[model samples]
Target: MQETRDAFVFRGGAMAAKPEIGSHDIEIRDCDVKYYTKRGFRFRDGCYDIQVINCTADAGGKEWYVEAFPMSFNVIGGAKGTNVYDHDITFIDCIASNNWHINGDSYWNGDGFCAEGTAYNLTYIRCESYGNTDGGWDDKSANPLLIGCIAKDNKKNYRFWSGAPGALLWNCVSAEPNKRGGNSDYVGLWTKGKIRIHNSSFVDSSKPLALNDWRVTPEQIANMNISVNNSLIELPEGKELPAPNYTVSNTVIRPLNETGLSANGVGYKKDMREAQILLTEVRPHQPRIEKEGRLLETKPLNVFSEKNPSGWYLSDWNNAKMKIAKGKGINDSNALEVSTNGSKGGGATYRTKRDSATIKFANFQKSDWALKMSIRTGSTNLSGLELRALTMAEAPKTKEVPLPGTLNGSITGWQEISIPLAKLKASASEANFANFAGFYIRANGSMAGPLYIDNVRLEPMN
Candidate 1:
């Protein structure tokens, strides 16, 4: 490699090895990588605490892997022994543009900044990626976080499909949709699974926000949690939404008409062009990276609240009586208590609130998550207790799994229970659990006393 004109010319960039022999805590900064074969820069093999700053990757990718496509700045992590993933990787003030592998595939190839193979805790700050073949920022990390990043002129500006403890982006920019040179631009921000976008801007994009799923079925898209807050979405004429059926709060929508301006003479296209000019300069404008503790960290999905028990209600059957009792839960909070008086079977359900037609819940596709709950039993004979994830089909189905047998008889105080998500049993003939509409706790056979359940949650596997 030669350092000419303050740019490092290299064929490619990557780090790969076995898990125990992998590199860590490395930093590569102020380099320009261009005209490469295969990939530009890739971080693999469980590398953690790495940083790439003030770098530019351009005109790379002649041949690349289909599983992990070539990108300007990339990170690929796969299952080595037990989910080997690159963690705590950060890209700061980097630019990825004009990267392509056109002859490889139609759409599922090449990107600007890509993180595949289930990497975790990747943060991109003040980065701008544009004009790539596929996505500008196609990140599939466990908890990929982007702040003050701008993406423009790519097929998809930002494609995020992470799983539980999902993705978070704030103060980002997506502009100039369908302006790619090699591939046709598709949408602005394509996402699947849980995502939260705050104080972002989507300007002049035809389809600003769309699902990143191939199976664009309504039932499947309904299971996603895409929350956008305090953003500005300015679209062209005949376009309506930055996101459809998502939770958007305090967002301003400006539609460009024949005059190329909003009603109040707000020229969004001019603003985007000016933004492009400013971004083309060295050290583009970025927000102050405040002490927002661990931007890539994710929290467990708590299922219950102190008030109303988070919409959990009792449904009794076969002469069984059940109700939610307040101030009786763990730590004197609300809990779901089901008591039977010579009854056969009954349980409780937590029906998720629907946004339009979508049922916002977890999708069991990407990461390994476990169901955790605290159970306190006052009964003697508790048998055949099942937990089910209710689907969102026309004829809805359930994927049910039996609880632990430790809660059977003579079970005293609160016992913490953890069940892997893979334990959810279903027949091959049964429908897949695409989008979970709710959760169900069903009891078969006879019950003697009250069953107490509190602090239910779905947490990522360690």
Candidate 2:
């Protein structure tokens, strides 16, 4: 049956329930109900299969209440108690706004719309509500779906309790009131229930969206699956986010003071100690104690020392052979030689033009190892070194394998370079120096000055 209730006014004393409306579908459309001193529509006794379409309820200064007085006496407006003890309700394109509840001499409790007790399959579609003393829509029941609803400028947009499930919120926007002192409460959508938010934007509200608070635990969050994709969550600038733990596949994190190595795996402590030793000791050649009883520190090994053919393996080349142009301390020195075309500079610029050279090592083999070196290009010009394995043939042509770019800084200091064994293998796929083969280092391009290189070592992984 279609019912058109226009300009219907109700005040106090729950609306009398219609008698014996058995198995009949009721539709209330295009109705204007106002001045409900108690609840605009109290569906207590028993009302089922009811649909409210395009209907509005405006409580004109009536004191709205949830239960009764003494226990809870205030101007609690909006719909209280369903038409029946239990009913399946659906509100489509409806609006419930501007309701107030009075207490004693002052206005205390108020709400736009409030639903409690037992309710089932209640759906609100495209419903808009705003400007209420309390929340815009408060649902304490279960299985409620609010879709495409706009609840803005209300004290609280939507405040729901726990034990409520199947609450679906889609395409909903809740904003702050347009006036001052509106008391923007906690959140735009605050609920303790499991809610699914899809294609929704919650912005410019007092507080955007907040999930379960103290009542919820970490285990509950872990068990819950919240899939947020293609959604824009814009927070105010400088807003601090709460710490939330997340889990991913093939990833493990260790605590600050805990050992980083697995019990069944090789630890990093051993590798670190070996690195320290390599940094101090020059491989293949032992350090020589000078006449002054001071053990002289050996200069870093150069994988590409073919440019200095005569001084490549000389013991006192620092004091002989290559002329030191800018000698810093007892150990640091910059050696240079003028090019035939007058390209003489103190950096790698004046170095030899040999694109490749071979260095004979005592014993070498194909092994998983790490190469660490330091290169200081004192000039801004591009300079690099290459390492190539030499085959056991007469006058083997050295294959050029380019190294990383020079560090961007004053070459007065040293920058450590580390190349993993796997990386080296990937770079030189064709060359296989399994047993004993000499390696080469060549200087190429913009050789207007000398290049400073030191601290070269190849160590096997533990």
lDDT of 1 at 318: 62
* lDDT of each residue in 18-65, candidate 2, tens digit only: 223322266778876665544444443234456767877665433433
Candidates' C-alpha lDDT: 0.63, 0.43
lDDT of 2 at 39: 48
Best by lDDT: 1
Error of 1 at 272 (Å): 18
Please give, for residues 1-462, the per-residue lDDT of candidate 1 as tens digits. 221211331211112222333457678888777765446676664567778888887754333223334567777763232234566777878998866655433444568888874477777777898777688988887777777788988878898886556677666888776643443447888877777776677777668887656657887677677777677777666765445557877776777422332233221222223322443441222222211111222347666555433234446566455567888898899887766555466666665543112222222224555668888875465777878765455433446787774776666788888876555635545533334345677777566667777887767686
What overall lDDT, based on C-alpha atoms, would model 1 receive against the true structure?
A: 0.63
Query: Where is model 2 poorest over a 10-residue stretch in terms of lDDT?
Result: 68-77
* Residue 390 C-alpha lDDT in model 1: 55
- Pick out the ten consecutive residues of candidate 1 with the lowest summed lDDT: 286-295
Please name the candidate that would achieve the greatest TM-score relative to the true structure.
1
